[model samples]
Target chain A: MNTSVNIAGVCFKNPVTTASGTFGSGKEYSEFFDLGRLGAVTVKGVATTEWKGNNCPRIAETYGGMLNSVGLQNPGVDYFIKNDIPFLRKYDTKIIVNICGHTVSEYCEVTERLSDEDIDLFELNISCPNVSAGGITFGTDAKMAETVVSEVKKYAKKPLIVKLTPNVTDITEIARAVVSGGADAVSLINTLKGMKIDINTRKAFLANKFGGLSGPAVKPVALRMVYEVNKAVDVPIIGMGGISNTEDALEFIMAGATMISVGTANFANPYATVEIVDGIKEYMEKNNIKDLSEIRGIIE
Target chain B: MKKFIFAEVVEIKHMIEDIYDMYVYAPEIAKNAKPGQFAEIYTGLGEAILPRPISFCEIIKEKGLIRFCFRVVGKGTKHFSEMKKGDKLRLLGPLGNGFEIPDAPQKSIVIGGGIGIPPLLELCKHLKGEVHVFLGTREEPILVEDFEKTGAIVHVCTENGCTGYHGYAITLVDELNIPADMIYSCGPKIMLKIVSDWAKKKNIRAQVSMEERMACGIGVCCGCAIKIQKKGEDDWHSLKVCKDGPVFWNDEVIW
Candidate 1:
């Protein structure tokens, strides 16, 4: 009957939260459904300063998935503290701020600035592949990931969930690295690097030429990586990528995700997160399941 | 509030090669929808995840119907063109800001190129002034009768000289020497830029509806960001075409 999940002692009302970058601090989607229904609202990446992002044509639709090279366009942590925080505080949901930066200090600067804010968790985004510096640069390399997480951990007051990129060869190595560097929990996998070309134009479909692919297409790879990371590390996993319906969510849960984040599905269905939340409860009631733990990583 | 509903397809018509007109019965959307606003239509195909953002060509509030006139550009639109009447489509809409209508009667010029012509039809119908419509197409012009039905002065220009005036619609506007207090347009970026420039030269207020490759038709995904700067601003900011506007003041756009 219990649906609440605790990650690093911070309890989410349910095991459903939106993926960062997909849900913009729960502002637009808040118009569709009540924000309080979500376990947590993960805001977009906030840096020390505002980012202008890439260029037009930043997104392209592919087979069962989409590619985005938004480059973490944000209004900075100060803007979040001034505008987003107060707005989100009006809701009853937990706030998980996703922090992004170009360097180790930049990440710490944002974390230190937000350390005093009334938020629930800090999702350290060391896995954004769209940016040229400091994002996937730190996430793909185990040593860099450890260094960035440790550096940011010194400043972050709340539980730090290091988001991982799926572009790496061994995702578990990076998972172990972040965990070793004082990460309270970890979330994976971020978008996988992918590209599409316009056959008529003979040019890259996305303005950046390459973008991060997220959707149902990436779900299998994300699930495999989540399972592998779960086996390799003791930290709770927040699984994501291509999670649209409750069944897809349950697959991630059974694959060992402590909490699942809905990404690209939100675009396809604005009510995707809330629907999954309700669907999970309905599923549990129908199956006579007591708690999510009964199904969490049950496949193993 | 935007509603994601299963709208029953009322009618689908193949107006021309690659272009089709689809009408759906969704009272909630039809009641709330304004001209220039768009709907995110899901293909129902599992392979295509993102919905195709199609603008409302017409909103028949009396019958609780909304028409989407779109060309078969890609997989999603092609799928929509193949849909039959009575088929239910997953639609999320009344999204993005629509064109602003002035209160007082004034001279207005509405320009549209190719597929962009459909969105301007509703705006023309709702305008309270002298409406001058200039439609530009490659070979054949569609929606001439629809615009004509609105009682607006409709002018057609074809690129191939197959019909109407020869050359682009903007040139037709120049040749006709049509004077207006405001101008509105929707088309390819290059065409919009020309319209924006033409509006700037005349010192008239102008609004343009932009198009971009979009994932989410909502502002959540900063996918369809268009560079914009206010009149006095030094630097441009990335504004979501889905949320801030698929419609923006022509002068504010960093074209």
Candidate 2:
């Protein structure tokens, strides 16, 4: 029988959480199901500077999944900390707020402000492509990744979990760069950027022309990254990509993820958040395992 | 908030040349369904990633069924068109707001252009007396025969001069000069606008259902906001089409 393990001293009741932007503050799903049942809920992405997000046609649907180019259209960090945090604190489950920044200083600034709050953990979103810079830069380079993690880690009084973007050349290098820079844990596989075109109209289906693909379509890629990063890092890994079923969630745990987050699948089925949490418990019971830690990194 | 019960396709009736009548067995929503509310149905083949939003044409709760009429346009509707008897579709419905007809109208003139005809079909059931239905299409193929089952005085306009009263629908309405106290219309946006203008000029009451790029279908996404001219307000205000409408007073819409 295994018990819960500490991640940088932040205690998680369980190991299941919804990915950022996938779960809308947990209130919407609460109408259909109870939110407190889940171990954690990662709210929508929050950027250092306010963003309006992309233009129209920001979303599209494909087989077993959907694409979203919300482009992190969130109220600025100050608003999230001041207004959103109070309501979020009421939930029994832990709050692991996801934060994104355009520049390295912005990351530090947001982290420093968050350091004094009674927050649980801060997940750094170095993964998002910086739109104003005219190129998808931040996640691709090791030096920049290390710089971002190190700076944010300095002011992040809470545990720091770096979310890795999959658009990089080598997933392991980016993971190693952040881990070496004093990050406590890391989340793998933010959305993979993609685009689709309409042949008849000869135009892009999404207004932004590109979106991050999630759901069953990207599960294999997400698994590979989780498996790779689990091998390369000492920190805990929060794995997510196209998780719609119990078997898919188990795959991430077996691949060495300490916890997992569900994204695109929630849209098709709103009750998926707590449903997956129950699923994790069912798996542990069936396997005769007393603790979920026994399953992590056990994959050959 | 209703449970999603199984809805079987009892019969796939080809009403018009390209249009189909997919009769379903949706017990709960149908039993409590109201006119103007729509349902989201999974195209039998899963060709459409999201369920196609179709307004309920007729809800016969005694038989635990509702009917939807759709013209084959894109992949989803075309695949749904191929469905046959005994096919089951997972449907969630009786969604969005419907038109609230006035307490009294001397003569009701219902205008339906192409796909818009199906939604107004159910209105005839709730309304009293004989209604004058003005139906229009580009040609005879898109015109349906089942519309006459309502027993209303029907008029049609075909662009190709192959149908009754050949010409634009507005022309037929203007020429007939029917003394309509209220007009409920649904069609392509342009047609609805013209009908609204005509109703405005004629001093008749009109209600319109608008369509837009919908995401959640229920609401919440904020994707479907239409500008509505509010009474005494200087600026046009935004109203959620999915929740506040799909149905609105004809004059309130900014067009």
Candidate 3:
């Protein structure tokens, strides 16, 4: 059975890629499972400079999920090129670097710096909800989303995939905006904005007060958004949010996603990605489905 | 590479009200465990999605066993309390950078409060020089005998003065006029802040173990970040408690 799905001109061995920031450049999770088993390893967001992120108490456990305000803490592009790239090169999977920044130039600087790197794709992150300035600014606005994508596309040598945030009024408008600019594909939904309060202390649980929520609770909304964006745009959609099992991945695919990403579930079970991969293969055999294209949008 | 092992529960004992001591037979984990390192204990409950991170109270390398002492705080710890002996627990560990104990024979004062007392036991047992342990709790003190077993001078403090000293653990040190070349501490943020302030005023070096709600006990999830200052840098950088440290020099902390 053919499990491979091509986004843009790049071909992933399978449609299973770890979501950005959840998988730390394939170093920590490599302990439980091999990096090569994945179709692609999407590294955490890298910026033009090192980001200290927010203060402590940055994460809180919510019902059926969790909230985080990690603020995209990373060691910058130089460190990623020196340390993380060499480690990930040892694996056979495709590398999709997620780029984050405070300004449009900051995003282009990272893309330009990584021009000579061995990465297969770039997931331009204008959707991070934790930061105050640039994270959700570009994603929530239609004109801004198109402007950032077009600006980054000029510098990026690899295929550019725009990651969309779900905290917007209308997600399809932003999806169509990015596709109108020069995006090869699109991935959604990047965590919904949420907050948790400590009753005893009468204060917010997270230090940042507001955080991005991800997990099983957000799956239904993600599927609905993916289905709507697929119908609205001509680009391949990478659906993710609260994807825990093979059935969840299948749901995203059936809802018209070309691929699916596993995020918060990795914290619970490190072997979840590989398990879903095997489960997808098992499902194909049972249903006599030859390729993923047959079931890509079967519900429609 | 880090390995997750299924450790069989060898023994479980109720140390005090709501506190439990569980001994697990995990050779691989026990073989490499250090003083301040912790393990992520899987609760096996669907409601509790993330693993609860618990520190190693003791490590008997000869028997290939590790002891974890924890209080039943939430649903996760409650699940651990219900577990029976011989049951296998999926544990991911011996993670995080542990306490650094130099063999220079310096006078060391180890201060721990409530649940924070457990990680210090391993450090006290291994320290070669003069070690004085001061532990404080809200009410009933757990693992006092275990601390005494380490052969260090153990002092206790409770909120109501029902045990050893009155008030906080730092007050005990102040009343005794304890002279120390260094201090090691782990407790609630407020207590640690007091201890850190005392250490700074006295010009004594101190290393503190910090706690945060963690997701991946590994560095992947940037959930457990603690602000820290580098040796020569003036700027504070967010360091992962699970990777950079559960233990950091008191001066490095931004508290």
Candidate 4:
């Protein structure tokens, strides 16, 4: 009956938390349900400075998913510490801040600024594909990913969980690299890069011409990556990419995700996170499963 | 307050070739919904994950019903068109800041283009004083009768010259030269820009509803961002159209 998970000495009440950028500091979704219901609330990416993001037409719907090139628009760490941290402190859940930057120093600057904040963890985002620099650039390369993680680790007082991009040729190699460079835990897979064209206009659908694809369409690939990364790295895996319902949640857990994040599905169903949380408990009870650890990575 | 509800389809009507009117029985949404606000209508298909954001055409509070008049633009809208009475679909609604109604009745001019004409019908019903409505369409016009029923002077314009006015609706508004205390509009970005410019020239305060490609109809996704400059501010900031406003004052928009 135990659903709690411990990631690098930080225990989440449950294994359910919102994916960054999708929940927006849990303000909009807070209208649907209580923020305390979930184990943790992962806020949007916070950069060293305010990001204007890309132009309009940033969102485009694909077959079983959606594409977005928001470019990690944020109000910076100072704004987040001043505004978001106080708001999240009212909740019972743990606070996991997702940090985004354009350079190694920029990443460390945010980490250093937030070191004294009352947050629980730092989700270093090197996987955002929409940005022109510093995001997926460091994520796709092992040496760069290792260097960023090790550099930011020096400034981050809280346990750092590096988010990995799926655009890399070998996801496990990057996973091993981050762990080697002092990443306490790892989360994967960030959106897969894809594009869509408007047939009538004969132009790209998204303003950025390409966007990170996330939703049910990317579930199978994400599950495979999570399983592979689980085997390759010793750190706990926070699996994501296209998780909507309880069945999807259980699959990722079986595939070796210590915790799961609800992403694009939140747009389709605002109550997706809480539903999966409740659904997971209901599933464990119905099957007479005592603890989540019994089934964690049971697939292999 | 906004809510998520499974609204039952009470009625459906095909008004024109691609446009259709759907009335849903949702007492909470009907009671809370205001003109210019929209609802995220979820398509039950797994393939299409995002909901279609449809604005309120009418809020029938007495009957606890809300009407959504939309055209079949893509896969999601097409699914809504095919829905029959008694079918229920998930809807998250009363989203975004609606149009602001002045306390004192003032002379107002409301303009809409194509599918954007629907939300104006509800705005006209709520507005007071001298109201002039200019509706523009590519070919044939719909909802002219509905606007006329609201006792507003309805002017129809078509691009093909097959209707009331020969040219665009804004051109007809210019030709009429009607004096107005305020102007309101919703349509294509190009048309909205023109309306904003025209209102500025006349020194009349104006509010225009905007549309952009959206993912999460709520504020979280930051998908539908519009550049807006607040009063007394030198720089324009990216404001979410889904949360900050689908309706904004013409002067505030960075266009």
Residue-level lDDT tens digits of model 3 in B32-131 = 9999999999876666688999999999999999999999988889888888999989999899989998877878899999999999999999887778
Error of 1 at A28 (Å): 1.2
TM-score of chain B of each: 0.98, 0.91, 0.97, 0.98
Better of 1 and 4 by lDDT: 4
The segments of candidate 4 whose C-alpha lies over 4 angstroms from its true place after superposition are none
**lDDT head-to-head 3 vs 4, winner:** 4
lDDT of each: 0.92, 0.76, 0.91, 0.93
lDDT ranking from best candidate downward: 4, 1, 3, 2
lDDT (Cα, 0-100) at A21 in candidate 4 = 93
lDDT of 1 by residue, A1-300 (tens): 999999999988899999999999888898899999999999999999989999868998888888999999998888899999999999989999999999999999999999988998999999998999889999999999999999999999999999999998899999999999999999998999999999999999888999999999998999999899989999999999889999999999999999999999988888899999999999999999999999999886
Who is ahead in TM-score, 1 or 3?
Answer: 1
lDDT of 4 by residue, B107-129 (tens): 99999999999999999999999
Residue pairs in steric clash, candidate 1? A1-A290, A64-B47, A215-A242
Which of the CAPRI classes, incorrect, acceptable, medium or high, describes model 2? incorrect
* Candidate with best TM-score: 4
Q: TM-scores across all candidates? A: 0.97, 0.80, 0.97, 0.99
Off by over 4 Å in 3: none
A289 Cα displacement, candidate 2 (Å): 1.9
lDDT of 1 at B69: 98
Model 4 clash pairs are: A1-A290
Error of 2 at B37 (Å): 2.8
- For model 1, the stretches where C-alpha displacement exceeds 4 angstroms are none
Q: Isolated chain A: TM-score per model?
A: 0.99, 0.95, 0.99, 0.99
